[model samples]
Every structure is written in structure tokens, then in C-alpha cells.
Target: MPKLKVKKSAKKRYKLIGEKKFIRRKAFKGHLLEKKSPKQKRNLGNKVVVSYSDTKAIRKMLIC
Candidate 1:
């Protein structure tokens, strides 16, 4: 059987912590920073865990 290849894009973005947990960066941190308040920008800088519903799919793509 052929090896199952992980998605390169997901591998670069999401990271696996252990068996099930995955870490991801918060959205809105990439653009429009000029209009966002300082507090909002600060909050966006924080990394967040992926939601339970989305974790499974992300894990599959990020398998490494």
C-alpha cells in the first residue's frame, strides 16, 4: 500500500502537542492591523488550541 502523505500546508500551520491536542494561531492576526485596537491586536497575538470539533480533522492533516 502507498504511504499516506500528510498535507504540507497543514503541517506548516498546525502543530501536534501530543496524541490528540493541537495548537493553532488565532485568526485576524495577518491583516488589517492598522484599524484594529491595540488590545485586539494583542489578543490576536496569542496562540489558541483548536476546537474539539475541528481537532480531529486538523490532526489527520498534521500527522507527523
Candidate 2:
């Protein structure tokens, strides 16, 4: 069989944690930060696990 290539976009977006779980950056912090509160910006800076509903699809993209 041919080598399974990983999706470049997924590689840049998601990070593999352990076995199956993946972590990603929170959204809405990309721009227009002036109106956002400190607390909101702080929370958005942290990485969050991908939603359970999307786990399977992410794994496939990662070729895990």
C-alpha cells in the first residue's frame, strides 16, 4: 500500500496529545483585541481539546 499522507492544514492546526486526543487553539482572539476584556483574552490564549463530536474526523486527518 502507498504511504498515507497527513493533511497539511490539520498538521498546522491540531496537535496530538497522547493516543487519540488532540488540542487546538481557541478562536476569536485573532484580531480586534481592543474591545475584548482581559479575562476573555486570557482564556482565549489557552489551548483546548477538540470537541468529542469532531475527534474521529480529526484522528483520520492526522492518520492516527
Q: In model 1, which regions exceed 4 Å deviation?
A: none
Which 10-residue window in model 2 sums to the lowest lDDT?
A: 13-22
Off by over 4 Å in 2: none
lDDT of candidate 1 over 1-64, digit per residue (tens): 9999989999878887877888888989898799999999999898888889998788777664
- TM-scores for all candidates: the values are 0.85, 0.87
In Å, residue 21's CA in model 2 sits off its true spot by: 0.7
Clashing pairs in 1: none
Per-candidate clashes, comma-separated: 0, 0
Q: How much lDDT does candidate 2 score?
A: 0.93
